[model samples]
Target: MPFVICLLFSWFLLPIDSAPAVASDPLLICWNNQVKPLQNRFVQLSYQEQRNELEHSAEPWQQTPYQASGTIWVNATNFRQIDTLRNTTRNRTSFTKTQADTQTLLVKHGDDKLTSVSRAMLDEHPLTAARYSPIRLIEYAYQHHLRPDSASSTNQATCYRTTINQTVISLFIRRADGLLDRATLLAPDDMLGDVLTTLTYQDYAAVGPSQQPTRVIVDKVNGKVRDQVRLTQSIVTDQAPTLLDTPADYRLDMTPTPVATARSEKYSDHVYFVTLPHTDDRVMLVEFTDFVLVAEAPLNSENGELIIQQAHQLIPDKPIRYFVFGHHHPHYLGGVRPFVHKGATILCSPGNDDYVTYLVQAPHRLKPDSLAMAPKPLKLEAVGARKTITDGQFSMDIYHIGSQSAHTSDYLIYYFPSEQLLFQDDLVWIPKTGKPTRISTRQTGLYRAIQQLGIPVRTVIQSWPVADMGVKTEIPFAELAASVDSK
Candidate 1:
C-alpha cells in the first residue's frame, strides 16, 4: 500500500525513478532471401528507380560521374518536382541541384554538410536523422567490403550495421544497394511512434554498374507523394563524404557556462542555456533542484569537458550527475561521448530509440574517433508529452513536440517549474528586440504545441549561444507565435 501510494504521489508532483537504466535488445535483421517477404511490410522502402538513359558500366563506379532527372516529394504534404541534375566528383564536391515545379528557386547542396536552400517547401527537419535514423534501423554495408555485383546494382545493394548512436551510422552493404531497402532497427517496446519522412523509389536504372534510382519520390509530413526527381547528376567517389571544417572564430559562449565569478552563487536549481540572441549565442546556466542535469552536450566533449570538471569547484561536493539530450543531432550528440564515458544514462523522449541510436553511431564524417564511433553503451529514460524531474524544491519537465522533425525526433525542451525557467531549443531564438527569422515547420509547430499544452513556463532559456536566459518580462510565447503567424 505504501509503495503504490508513493508511486502515484511521485507522478503527482515529485521526482520519478532514479536508477541506472538498461540496454535495449539490438535490432535484429534476418532475410531468408528465399522467403521473399511482402513489400508492403516495408515502410517508405526505396529501391533503385530505373532510367533508360544511364548505362551500367562493366565495372563499379570508382569515380564515376553521371546525371539523372526525376521528381522528389518536397514533403509528405503537397510537393512536386520541377527538374534536377547532379554532379558527382568522386563524392568530393558531390553537388545536386533541383528546380521547383514550374517556378524558379533552385535547391543545391554541395559536399554533404555544405548545403544551400533557395525556396524548397522546407527548412530544417525536427529530426535531421528521421530518415537516416530509420535507415540505420535497417542495416546496410560496412567498411570497403564491396558487394561482388555493386556496379551492376548501380548503388543498389544489401548492407549491415557496425554501430548506432546520435550521429554517424555505419552498416555493411551486401548484394549491392548502398542505401537501405531491407533492414530492421531493434526498437524498444516504448519507442515506436509515427513515421516522419518516407521515401519511395519508383524505378531503377543501371548507371555504370550501379543500380541508380531514376524515378525516386518521397513523402512529406502530411503524406503526399511526389512524381519525379530531376536528378541533375550523380557522381561516385572513392573518397568519403565532404565535411565542413569546424570554425576557428567559434568560442564556447560561457555566459551560461558558470564562470568563476557566478560559480559560488546558488540562485536556482540547475542552470540553463538559451542561444537565442539576447545574450549573443551564450548559454544561461540555471541551477535547479540543489543539483544539476546538463542537457545537450554537442559543443563536443573537447570544448565543454572543462565545464564538468569545474562543476566540482563550483558546487563543492554535490556529486555532478545526470545529463539530458535536447534533441538528436549528430554534430551535437557526437560531443556526447564524453558523458557516455562518464557512465551517465541518456534521458530522452519515447519513440526515438531507432533514430537516436542511428545518430549516436551513423557514419557521416571522415575522421573517426572512439567517441565518434559510439563507445560505451547508453542508458535512456523515455518521457511522455508531459513529464517532470523534480528534487522537491526545484522542478523541471519534458514536454511533447510534434510536426517538428526538422531538428530531431527524440527531443525535449527542459522546463523548470519553480524558477519558471523554460529551456526551448531550435523553436524560437529570442529576437533582437525579438524579431523572428526564417524558421522551420518543427520550430513553428513546437511553439503551437507549447501554447496548446499550457506548460506553465516563466523565464525561457534558449541553450545555444550558451547564455540566453532571463527573468520573465512578458509573455514571449504569444509574441513568438504571432511572429511565425501561427494559426
Candidate 2:
C-alpha cells in the first residue's frame, strides 16, 4: 500500500504543467508546479549550489609533520564546585594541554587536589565518547534534512541522532542561509540524566574559501557554562583525512571536579532532598522517596545523575521502585536514561511521557563510562492535576504548575504535609538583601498558585534558589511579580 501511494505520487509529479511565465529580481515565482513536488518536504536549491561550491574550495584541515609534543600550562583561578546548600572551595589547581599522537591530552593538577571530572568520566564510563567537532554540524544539517516543509512541524521531528556511545545529538544550521548554526549533545540518562550541551558558532572567516566560526563557545543554553576559549582559527586542508579516518581518541576536557559526595537533605523522616550539580551556574536538588518512588529531576544530566544516586542510597536495601520526572525540557528529561536503566516505573504528566519517549528516551545516549546503558521501556503512570506519594503517616502532594511559561512544561511542585515546604521551580525567587533589579509574571503566577492552592509554604524551594535557606524569610514573591509587571 505504501509503495503504491509513492508510485502514484511520483507519477503525478513527473509530468510538467503549462503555466504563464513570470519574472522578477530575487526571481522567486509561483513555480507552483516546479515546487509542488516539494510540498511534501522542504527544498532550498540555491543553498545546495552554494554548499557544493564551498565543499570544493581549498581549505586547510590539519598541520602535518607532527613535532615532538610540549605542554603549555595555566593555573585556573576561582575554581570550585557550587553546592546546593553552600560553596566548596578546595586547593589551587593547574591545567596543561599537550600534543601527543597528533591529539591534545590535557593534564590538570591543583593544590585543592580534586580529580578532574573529564578524566573521571572517561575512565569510569568508557562507553560515552566525546562528541565530534562542531564543524560536522554543517555537513549533518545538509544531509539530515529532506526539506523545509518536513522540518516545519514543531513537535513532529526527532530533534537529534545517536552516537556510538548511545548519545543523541541535534545538529542545526541557519534557517535562512543554511549555514551551520550550532551543534548540541544530549547525554544518555544512564550516566548523567538527559542534559543539553550547546556549541554556538563565532568569529567566522574564510578558512581557505569557506566560512566557519573559529571561536566557538560550547555550554548549556541556560549558562550552565563549560568552557570559553577563542577557537583561535580553523585550518582546512586537503591534508585533512576523511572524517572516518580521524583518530577516535581525541577528547574534550571538562573543567568540573569529580563529584565525590552527593548527600540527601533529610527533610522529614519520610522526605529527602538530593542536590544536583549543573553547569548552568545554579543549584537544584531532587526530592525522592526512600524506595525509589518519584524523582526530582530538575535540570540536566548532572542533576539527573545525582537524583539517580539519591534514589539508590535513599534505600540501598531496595532498588528505586518509581521514577518521577519533575519537568519537561529537551535538556531536563534526557537524564532519565539512568532511571530507565534502573528499571523503575516512571510517573509523569500527560504530554510529558510521550515527549520523553520521542525526544530523550528513544535516543538512549550514554556517556564515556558505560557503553552498555540503553533506554528501557518504562511502566508509565500519568498524573493529572494532582498526585500523592506517602508512607501512611507522611505524604507529599505533587501539583501541576499553572503558569504561562514555556520554560517548563509538565512542570510539577511538591508539598510536604508536615514540613510546610513547597516546591515550584521558577514560580518565585527570594530576593537577596539589596533591592533586586526586577521580577517576572511567572513569579507572579507562583504567588497566585501559592494562594490558590493554599499551600502553607514556609520554605519555597525554587528550581533556582532565590536566597540561601538561612535568609529565606526575606523572599518576596509578590514584590518580584509586581517588579516584573512594573517593568
Candidate 3:
C-alpha cells in the first residue's frame, strides 16, 4: 500500500516540475545575447567618419563634407576614445579625447584642454550617452537597470524599446545572429526640437569571440545623413598600460572653464568691446544712463557668464537691460540663457523665437547653470527688418541682413550712429594681414546693405577674432570696401 501511494505522488510531481520551461523574458534574452559574447574581451576599434557640413555650418543647405578618424578602446572597467576631425573646406583640424573610469570622466577638446566631470553625469544626459560604443552602451544599460517596456518583432529583426530618464531608446537585434543591428535615440534639442538620431550597423565581422559592425551610418529623422563611419580595424587585446593616462602637457581642470581670461577694451564711453579669453569670439556691451545692453552672447553659458562678469565690472551700478544676438547659429546665440536669467529682454532676429525660447526653458538638470538653478520667464523681443534702441542722446540700429546674404536669412547687424561703428558677425571675415585674396558674396552683401540702409559708418567692428596678435577688432570701413572691390 505504501509503494503504490509513493508512486502516485511521484507521477504528479513530474508534470508540475516540467511546465514548458516558462518562456524567457525577451529583454533579458536580447541583453544576454549581446553582452555575453563581449563579457571578458577588450575591444579596440578604429574607424573613419565623413560628416555633412549643413548640420553645423552657418551656410544653410551647404553640404560640404568633413572627415574624421577615431579609435576606441573598451574593457570591463575603462573606456577611451580619441578622435581627430579635419575640415578641409574650412582648413581646420581639431583633436578630442574622452575617457572614463569607474568614478570620473575626462574629456579633452580643442587645444588639449582636459576637463573632468562626474561619470554619473552621463546617466543624466542622453545625447552624451548616445556617443558611446555599443559595448559601452550595453554596460551602461545594464548598470542603470534599464528595462525594456515592450518588445516587437518584424520579418528581419526584433526591437526592444526602453526609456532612460527622458530619452527614448530603441534597440533592434538581427534575427539571424541576434546582434545589435541598429539603435535609435529620440532626445530633445534646444534648436531642432525633438531630434531622432538613428545609428544603423552593417557588415558584421568577428573579432575573437565578439562581433562588431564594420560600417555604421548615422542619420537624422529629417532625411539628413549626418555621417557615415567605416570601421578600418578591430581587435581583441589587453588594455595598454597608459591607455587612459593624460599627457603631461595637457591643461587639466576639474571644473568647467570655457573662458580662461576676459579682457574688455573701451571702444567708446558707452560701448565697450569685450574679447573672450582663448577663442575668436567677442561681445559688445553698451551702457545707458539707467541700464546696460549686451550684444552677441557667443559660445556656451560659461562664456556668457564671463562676459556678464566683465559687463558688471565695466558698468557697476546698472543692470543688464537688453541682450541682442546676431542670428540663430549656436556660436552666436548659445549663451543667451545667462542673459535671460538676469532678467534681460532678448532681442533676436525674426524666426528665432522658437529656438531662443527652447534654449531658456530647456532642462539642464544634469549640470544646472545659473538660469537653470533660478528659473525665470524668457523675456524675448523680435527684431524685424529694422529696429532701433535709443536713449534720445544715443541710438543703435539693428538691421536684418535679409535673404540676399549667403550665410543666414535671419541675420542682424548692429550699428551705432553716434560712434559711427557698425558691428556684425560672420558677414565679413577680413584676414589679419589687411589684404584680400578673394571676396565672398557675404562681404559684398554687407556693402550692399550699408548702401541701401544709407547709414554713415566710419569704423566696422567684428564680433570675432577679438585679438589675433596682429588683427584689429575695429577696422576702418575703407578696408572692408577695398576687400569688396578687390579682385
lDDT of 2 by residue, 1-487 (tens): 0012222223223332222233420001212221222322321110000000101111111111111111111111001111111111222223322111112323233233223334544332211111112322322222333222222122322222323233334444443333445555554343223455666665555544344444455564223334433433234322211112223654556666545345456655555555543322122233343454645454344455566666656656666666665565423344565566667677777666654554343322233222125445666778788988765656778787633333344666667768777755445544545554545555666666667777776666654443343223224344544555665
Candidates 1 and 3, the one with greater lDDT: 3
lDDT of 2 at 186: 50
True-structure lDDT of candidate 2? 0.41
Choose the strongest candidate by lDDT. Answer: 3
Query: Which ranges of candidate 3 are over 4 A from the true structure?
Result: 1-32, 35-133, 136-259, 468-471
Off by over 4 Å in 2: 1-261, 278-290, 298-305, 365-375, 404-407, 465-487
TM-score of each candidate structure, all chains considered together: 0.42, 0.46, 0.64
**Tens digits of lDDT, candidate 1, 1-487:** 0012222222223222222212221112212121112121211222222222111221111123434444333221112232233444333323443322222233445444323332222222212212222221232221112222211222444332221221122222343323334322221111111112234433444333234344434443213222233332433322221123324542223234333222223335466332322222323343444555666544344433544555555555564356666665422343455565565666666766654564444332223334445566666667767767667766667775633524454567767656665665455544455444455565566666667777665545454544344322223555656656843
Off by over 4 Å in 1: 1-269, 272-291, 304-307, 310-313, 358-375, 404-408, 433-444, 464-475, 481-487
Against the reference, the lDDT scores of all candidates come to: 0.39, 0.41, 0.69
Estimate, for each residue in 1-487, the C-alpha lDDT of model 3 and write its tens digit: 0012222223223321111112253334444654556666667888788877555445434476789898877754567778899987878988887776555566779665466554335453333433435665655555554433222457777655555554556667676666777777765443333446788878877776766778887886444547788886788776633434655654424465354578888878888988776667788999888889999876567778888999999999899999998776766787788898999999977777876786676555434578878988999999898998987788889998866567777888999887788998766767678466668787789888897889888998878656564455667898878878774
Over the full model, what C-alpha lDDT does candidate 1 score relative to the true structure?
Answer: 0.39
Q: TM-score for candidate 1, please give it.
A: 0.42
